[model samples]
Target: MVARRRHRLIQRRKMLGFSQEQLAHQIGVERSTVVRWESGEREPRPWQRPRLADVLEVSLEEVDELLAAQVNEEPEAERLDFAMRNPAAVDLVTVAHLAQRVQQLNAQYDAAPSASLLADAGHCHSQVTLLRGFAPNGRIRRELCVSTAESAILMGQLVWDASQRRDHAVSVQYFDQAISAAREIRDPILEAHAQLRKGFVALYGTKTPKEGLRLCNETAIVGRAGSNVLSGLGFLHVGEAYAMLGERHDCERALGAAEESFARIHNDDEALHMFSPTQFDRLAGSCYLFLGVNDKAEQILTRSARSLVRWKKSQSIVLSNLTLAYIRQGKLEEACGTLHEAIDLIAETRGGGGLNTAFTAGREMSPWRHEPWVQEISDRLFALMTT
Candidate 1:
């Protein structure tokens, strides 16, 4: 017999755009194991439920509801719409549903065009904001506030990227709003991240390293109270800001502080997911490049490029920097070859950061524009621009 609980579970997974294999990969289970779970032949272990809950964007209790037999009830969407229309009726369940929707949208942001996600993301943010105003209980209100901050951060990233980093003021406004919500909730980690994003704008968008240094320092200080992932991340950028100012000694000192912070990050740290193994090398390489240490930059970026397999957007940026490192050292052929790899990633992800960096690397290779390989890359760049 087909279990009703299995049907609901399958339905929920599909509605959130997760195929069986995709969901299985996310939860670190075999496809066969996922099939057995959906067949109601087994239950996830207690230790596994948290990760499962995170992937499904539901609470542990709700994961149980999906595993057990159930009674007749309104579809979550119908109930959510009613709750949204009557905000005083909002509850934890409704808040959870909204949060899940945001997660679904965010999952697509890295791989999809920012313009494509803006309408749905904006609508969802509006609904969350409306519900936050009239949420019935303190607990419910707090949940909505968290959702607001999360959605606001996503909006800031999407808006900035969609504008090709041109709309700095608007994106900073969104980040500031997110910081306000985080502070109201007494969440230092959230506030620190929001500040760090603003630092990115100042450093890259406006080309102002002084302001970037101030904001990233603040993030590093606040993140220290939480986990080292954010603190290390803050100091990594701190080094970059110093490099932009052409202060090599200060940059290296900040990099040492960042490494020290990273050493303290344990497996169980809550912010571990925010870090990647190649991150330190990637930023350090870029810092050295800015400081005119091309040989050192090439060494670090080469290692980082080899290690970067995930986070394709970041991988592309690293490749672009690697290309620059090659060009500066008179390795024109190697530079062009590295750029091809970066361009492939840029084509796949359409990430603004990598796209911009790739162009910068292209401009630096102008001395050898007569070569066939150089012409080939220029053609690809033209196509990338039009598309």
Candidate 2:
């Protein structure tokens, strides 16, 4: 007489990298409707079942089977626990459960604070690592390695951001784990992604543009074997590193190459989901900022910020850089307004690069530092960082 959950259905959705909200949007239903369906309180209407199945990448009969299969409150959790206790018995379904959990955590990552996500991400990574050690030499082991690579990348990002980018060594260690896993699997896309993440620490945290540039070139080449998205993104950072080094011609060339790489992306590109329309603009704006072209930076950053509203971390950095552009143009009041907006987003996201950028913009407001508005904003940023 008790309501049950649809474990298989939920796992399928997460395994395919779709959050309940995303799945609902795809199926033209409210998120609560998807929630109810997963909770076994209500079934999808006949008209919606086909769309639901399509979103879930399941056949019509499989969709019905998933819906009719009543489940325990936390079947995935139970299976994972048992697998953890008896790792040698780990199978593909167990690997799917682990991968789905990691993906669910990743789904929540963008909007949430890194500190809030670190613990769960670390737990998932540890499980993946342990299972990898015990998994037999077969498809199950290979799948476990893939999950390890994914969870390692997530852990690296979480650790770096949670520490506000100060803890470089620990973050790099996790990224290395991912890179090693990718090499074992011979997966270029994953290898390039982990390498790019490691280079971010060098470029921003350590202030090493040359080292960052080296990493960018390496990843761009490695990415060529599989993913246009990673390659394009790598070139974008390559441009940023060139900008940091005051190499204008190389920066522009990198931008052009990035555009061409992006132009080649198809709907079925291996890493298409990572591609963002605003990425080029955001990095282009950074290039302009670095080159002391304040007007161009402001124009590009303003346009980029508009499309980046949904991504709090990236949008916050864009707003922070836009604040710098305003400051450089001697627009004190406008700079202060944009700084406040950036600070608000940073307070919500605790984005490491954005946090560092907001403070840098605040410090560069020295000409107007005597103003009460600037002083108040500085105080707010300090409070946000401490919290």
Candidate 3:
């Protein structure tokens, strides 16, 4: 229990944007102690609790409540319920929090025996619709909206999981419901996002990129001119569609348009949560990599790597692209290292599989499947895809 409190303290500290060393200095503890707390390997002494709470800028009572609520939550269902009720309280929580919340929701939905869970899922879906609508304004709004959107997204994601598990009819019904909710919210960006996701369902799982591209193109049309960030994302889908179609020139043109749109929106500081330099670079890098322009891909991807590392999110996608770039350069050892790092990072976040980022990487790497080192990585990655 004490160890759990310490872990929660570390989570709070991180959400507040404090580094381990910075937090340690503030609380007059060694950095090692902070690390231990984060790792759940040790606990702060009872006397240190107040100071820890103070340093985290959360009230001691609030900290105590959080620790008590979360420490004993072993099943995913309980965690999702807590997140739904305490959405506002979790704004400063880390990616880990979001992942855990999503996981619990998925688990509950899978094992559901009552209509209440379905209703709860619907409510969560509504919240996501609301939040995705709010994402274009700024960071504060994005942060505020994410908890709600996350809840909804998780429900939709569980539907997808069910589809994967052969509950096909149920999954299709759930997606339809989710899409309707998104439409009612009247958020073009999220509508576009939903369509993009549906496109993936068509392309990869259903083996119909043409149908997927049709949906993705609709998303781009709706998303364009809404937010520069969203516009770029829309273009990304267009580019992806072109790539899948084997239209290299069309892919390049769409990718170039994405980069141009992104450049116009680029800023020194994040302009809302909608647009970030890192995300733009990453998308550009991915497009170029797929186009087989290794030099251009490497340049853009390197920038993305640096930016994503600073943000501490999307590292898995970034690393996956970096591995592809290294493989292109015939840097076998570097590629292997990056692939391992990507796998580890993805395992840690455990949220992005729904995006099919890993599978996309595997598909992109198919060209190198015959290369010895690439084959080694491909074998491992393909196994993951199958299971």
Give candidate 1's TM-score.
Answer: 0.83
Per-prediction TM-score to the true structure, in the order listed: 0.83, 0.85, 0.51
In model 2, state the lDDT of residue 347: 88
Q: Give the Cα-based TM-score of candidate 2 against the true structure.
A: 0.85
Model 3: worst 10 consecutive residues (lDDT sum): 109-118
Identify the candidate with maximal lDDT. Answer: 2
Candidate 2, residue 324: Cα displacement in angstroms equals: 0.8
Please give the CA lDDT of all the candidate structures: 0.86, 0.88, 0.59
Residues 61-176 of candidate 1 have per-residue lDDT tens digits of 87887787645656788878998889888866577678778878877876787878999999999999899988754767877887888889899999988887889999999899
Off by over 4 Å in 3: 1-151, 158-175, 203-207, 263-272, 310-313, 351-387
For 277-366, candidate 3 gives per-residue lDDT tens digits of 576677667767767787788888777776665443356667777777877787767777777667665444442432255555556667
> Which wins on lDDT, candidate 1 or candidate 2?
2
Decreasing lDDT order of the candidates: 2, 1, 3
Off by over 4 Å in 1: 1-70
In terms of lDDT, model 1 sits at: 0.86
